[model samples]
Target: MMEREARRTPPELQELTEQLSLRWFGRPFIHEAVYNPRLRTTGGRYMLRDHSIQVNPAVEMMYGEEELIGVLKHELCHYHLHLEGRGYKHGDSDFRELLRKTGSPRFCKPLQAEQQRTVRHYRCADCGRQYERRRRVDTSRYRCGKCRGKLQEVQ
Candidate 1:
């Protein structure tokens, strides 16, 4: 993945933020916007401490720039409204309305590369054979591929 500075919203995010801010909030985003690698399990977040937006780098690395722009818009909604002293929280009415008005997505998909994606573990019910797979195996029909015994999950 690119460094967080390189990931700074990109040229597309910059343009999208400029347009969205003008259309939805009647202002411009003047602060630095960049991805923070430490953020896990979230699409984006606005830093109240600096008024900067920290987007999860996983978004671009996994979903591409188009989806990342949507997240940018979402964060910008918080940025603009907060700077103006309007209700800017996720549960606030103003925030919700601004999100809808800007056509921003509420959630983003988890990047498969971000963590362990799948695990299938089983053990034999009959002979105590254990099995582990990335894909699930049929418990009713398929037995331990090695011992031909019933399989159960071990871990």
Candidate 2:
């Protein structure tokens, strides 16, 4: 059996989140804020049950402090609005208005590493058509769409 190591939440992260809460939303953050290393795609997420905020540590490491702050602000918007019985979801009008009022970003910038992912290339044996995919495809199971030719991986 393998045990996963626990990652400690930095004290400064809590302090920064609290400060941003008061500075931007003019309200105190009474909940916890921690860095979650398991977050792969999203910059941050606000938990409705615990009212806590989980920030992806990679956002700061990959994009820097400015991007991190933007993520925090965006999450903070959801925090304040939800607590006040207002719209907190991205599709809600109140959420959009608050985002505009707070000057928080609507979307976080894509991580640099995510943009540099290697793409797999494939070609059809008969049609000579090419395709690019992020994940590998089974040549035996899949075939060309146009010419119904067998697909061969390229490099």
Candidate 3:
């Protein structure tokens, strides 16, 4: 099945961010909104120094508008609070309150493009020792450390 593309242009994203800010937070988002290709698992991030919001391109491309909006809101919570000299950190009360008020998710979903872990299970043929590895082990060359037994693939 094909995934829907929800990627927005930079200008469109900026407009959306501004609209959301005015609609929910009752403040204008003055800083720029830009897509960041380098952002992997993170949906969005608000730069403390530049006051700019960087959004992961994968948010909309893989997730959808709702997820993208949620990421935007999450970053906005950090943006507004930090600019006002209030508690903007995840641990702070103000940040938590804003998140609650805005209904923004505390964390973004993991990227769909992220590689899934490959776990290889192995057992010693002689000693019955078990081992889990990310990569395949050469059973012919590698021996069990415990009993120096030959290892066999479990699955």
Candidate 4:
């Protein structure tokens, strides 16, 4: 389940789960759902080892609850289908069908709030071409690929 660390209460989670389950699966989710802080890169994951659902808190923190709910539904597709002995794996027919049937999101999209933010800027020493990056580049190790020239930081 993916609601234990959730900012939402048990009752809220239960309600949310029910609503999503019904809206997507047309069936009730009878198990626990929880928020997992250790998740990374991925939006959510199903514990094949334990049958519990682990949702990335970053899904909500970065993307918001709507996307978080989508992540839940995506995981639920695995949860309910697995519990019912249906295709739970992503490549399985049942899983694919369920995704379409429930309108659950297939991919957990990242938050775009900072899409325009720039952290590092670079200039080509030879051509003065400019490049922007979100991470710092090692000037000693990196060279401008376009002009095969040295790159310098511009503020």
Q: How well does each candidate superpose onto the true structure, as a TM-score?
A: 0.63, 0.84, 0.76, 0.62
Poorly placed runs, candidate 2 (over 4 Å): 1-9
The candidate maximizing TM-score is: 2
Please give, for residues 1-155, the per-residue lDDT of candidate 1 as tens digits: 33233344456556666776777667888886766778887888999989988777778776676878788888988998999999999899999998898888777776555466587889887777666688877788787766688776676
- For 27-132, candidate 4 gives per-residue lDDT tens digits of 8877667766666568878888777666666667665678878888899999898889988999999999988977788888853433446678899999999998
Off by over 4 Å in 4: 1-7, 111-155
Q: For model 3, what is the alpha-carbon lDDT of residue 4?
A: 73
> In candidate 2, which residue pairs clash?
none
TM-score of 4: 0.62
TM-score of 2: 0.84
Query: Across residues 76-137, which tens digit of lDDT does each residue of candidate 3 receive?
Result: 99999999999999999999999999999999888775556678999999989999998999
Clashes found in each candidate (C-alpha, N, C closer than 3 A): 5, 0, 0, 9
Each candidate's lDDT (Cα)?
0.77, 0.89, 0.91, 0.78
Which residue pairs show backbone clashes in model 1?
122-152, 122-153, 123-151, 123-152, 124-129
Judged by whole-model lDDT over C-alpha atoms, candidate 4 comes out at 0.78
Candidate 4: worst 10 consecutive residues by lDDT?
1-10
